[model samples]
Target: MAKQAVIYKTEAGEREILRRYEEILAGWPVPAGRHHVPTREGDTFVLVSGPEDAPPLVLLHGSGSNAAMWAGDVAAWARHFRVHAVDMIGEPGLSARSRPPLDSTAYADWLDDVLDHFGLDSAAFTGASLGGWLALDYAIRRPRRVDRLAVLCPGGVGRQKFGFLFKVALYRPFGAWGLRRSIKAVAGVDPGDTPEVADYLTLMFTHFQPRRDRLPVFSDEALRGLAMPVKVIVGARDAMFDSAETARRVENTVPHAEVTVLPDVAHSIIGQTQPIMDFLTR
Candidate 1:
């Protein structure tokens, strides 16, 4: 038989792929490293925790970040839950996408496939930044599949007056790079050494691919579709968009939902392991 075609990469792309994969592996916070497994969505990668039979919880990394942001909390939570930290499909890290999820519904459906592959009927979800946006939208689309939704400093909300050129800057080829700058621009704080924050932004821009054609929930007005448990956490010092406005939207949409504004916290709430734990535990 002829040699099988190398569909995963071209020869020149091997080094880049290897380096990126190494970064992905090294970026994780939990021990026993990462394990590769194929899911209906694609080759969904996971960082395992606790026992196999434990309650499953999915951790969604924010924009420009890998699953490693959940590092600190997983080891602690795994005692009660089988933590599965996922690299968002098509964005970056180890999610091998045959086709990128193209829109809000598609992303939701694809994520459902991932959950299904693990035989999980429902899970506790946590996401940050762009991941937060995805988590909320996913819960809205598939309310029964998620038990509780936690979003930290999520994006895709509000109508802000922006400098015309500045608005266009978000769409450039180097958008993730601009994304990091934009985040810094929004946070109003110096980017301190907050563990994986810088690495998160770097991978997001350089490795993760955003499908611009994909319509995000930010465009949608109806949040009533999501009836399951939902929680919104906005950083008091977020350099991102209007945190209070986003929090109010979740509260209004979910009705009787939990909303928290973290004081002295920046956009990377995942870095604040204890607060995240207390929120999830409660």
Candidate 2:
């Protein structure tokens, strides 16, 4: 038999990571509903919160993360808009393990099915890292379907940095201690500050295989075509992407875009719950 493809380093690792994921979900702050939406790629998991009658807002987490990433912001966001936090396929979530080509339209098609399932013609979007790239891709391809766009340290808009790989490699030999340091360097946050979060990330990186391909950069013409309101929040100290370039490109092409560069922040942007809500509700 041909070797089976898997995302986690081992089956046991998958179980442990998912077990912890479920634990986080069990403590979800607000009244939330979880379900799977059928798509061409596979079954997509969605965590729904907020009032059914409120305007729809979709949340996308960064790579190596799931819907639980929004646990801190959901309660505030859910109060105003109906929030649908989606687990991107192929990630370490309950979603399908289908890894499609980034250059292809497969992701957009899957999203189309997801929106259709929710009976939504258009909705606001908030995405981080790889999720940010997905949101930009969808908005560029299906502009009419995006009511508004918000991204945090998003890829595609700026050049992706490869220096972090060397840092990761240098720490690989150090075992768990080195892994934590590497995570801190890449994430721009001290993992030790939050033991629970640090533990989860360490567990995830130890097993999960992150994507290696470079994120496709958005062309100036494509960005200029985005008519919906756009907001981009990136950290100045980001080790993964060129934040200055990202700010410059967005400001030049997407004139209406609101760009905020946090002076001392890094790839892991935290404490933006109110700012994002203000953008969505405004």
Candidate 3:
């Protein structure tokens, strides 16, 4: 039988990506320890840090990114909470490359395994982009396990604009330069500003073959059903979706959800550490 295929375009590409991954992780600013949490699906890789007794906070990265992407915010977050930065399964991280069906509860189940492994009954959850969608999904399915929820430019809550897809496709043929331009347009900041994150995303985009799963939007019923406090932040200038519209939907559907639309920010909304921390702690 042929060897099982992974997300990368080729085995060599996977090796190269893994090499860069370790290099980026080694340069993590804050002190962290690696934990290869065993789950039913596979071994979930997590970066554990912060105080032993501090309130727990789980961090999930956007698509094509990994736990290392949280380097910018982990230090401050770790100060107030015990941080668990998880390299989402099947992404460009140390976690097993088992791509679970997006529409099913596979992700929720996998996360359940992770939380159980950590001996955590519940924890505050924060996720970016695709990770945000995952967090929301889990929270909706297992509300009692999520003490609080905060999301950054999450999908599944609003209509994804075709304009975003057109722009991304338009830039693909131009290679890395065009890809970087597209990324800048959506992410709102120059990739050069954060060279490590830029490099990692670029590498993953160049090498990895992302899953072609369609994410479903969360219904008003689901959003309104959330029992815990929910907070949402989006980039006013986000090209991927109508950030204002997203905020509106979240605000209207989830009456109690605190929504903030940051001016001049894009899909890759940054500079939200303080706002999210305030919400999480408050």
Candidate 4:
């Protein structure tokens, strides 16, 4: 008997996913300089954009998404800051598919390695969904490295209801239809709007084997320990977690935190270009 692989079903499946991933990257609004930075965990891939002398801003995407997801937001963000969009090590990106446990501090150390590779002492950090949780974790573990923080639909700050996990469990049986429903439930939008997005995500869902480790909740002590400016925004319609509860927790826990609940927005947040820029530049 042998252990089964989890990241990709087959070598051909991996190739096809990588091909689509490159195609998506090719369509980014701005040209990005790709770099493979060495870390103790593995080689981390990052897409670099914006001016060289500008302040550094790191972008982290949600689970199942790569750096290319920032295509729409990169142009405006690049104007004021040098952006580095990272591909999480264990996700469906070009980075190493070897996933560290979600509950461990390996991700924080990996992020530290990335920053050190870039020679950045401190920088403003922005992340969405799981990315947000990683950013918050790093800020908590290595407070001195994060100058400011902005999170969209971040996890770990508050509890993730069991219902979210239950919805995910239903994705396999429901197929594309189930996936669409799950997306709408969490993202507040139909995935079919964009042909490429739909195709790419569909392929990922069908072929990519994402990590199954449950995300851990952050302690109140960790949240209270953050001294840097923190801005948290959650969608009003987010079904994955209670946005109101998250906002309340952050606002109550962190002295310099500001929480905003956007009307009609879901877990997949949008229309945040100016607001995030304002926060990072201010």
lDDT accuracy of residue 62 in candidate 3: 88
RMSD values, in order shown = 5.4, 2.0, 2.2, 2.8
Question: 1-282 in candidate 2: lDDT tens per residue?
Answer: 112236799989999999999999999999999989988888889999999999999998998999978988999999999999999988899998888888888889989999999999999999999999999999999999999999999999888999999999999999999999998988876865777777888999999988877888989999999999999999999999999999999999999999999999999898999999899889
Off by over 4 Å in 3: 1-5
Tell me the whole-model lDDT of each prediction, alpha carbons only.
0.63, 0.92, 0.85, 0.83
Rank candidates, lDDT, best first: 2, 3, 4, 1
Looking at model 4, report the run of 10 residues with the lowest lDDT sum.
1-10
How good is model 2 by TM-score?
0.97
- Stretch of 10 with least lDDT, candidate 1: 1-10
Clash counts for the predictions, in order: 5, 0, 0, 0
Candidates in order, TM-scores: namely 0.74, 0.97, 0.94, 0.92
Candidate 1 residue-wise lDDT, 154-272, digit = tens: 76653222343363366455565565555455543234654245545544444444443323545435576767667777777665556777777777766767788877775556455
Judging by lDDT against the true structure, name the best candidate.
2
Q: On lDDT, who's better, 3 or 4?
A: 3
- Residue runs of model 4 more than 4 Å from their true location after superposition: 1-5, 165-174, 192-195
Deviation of model 2 at 59, angstroms: 0.6
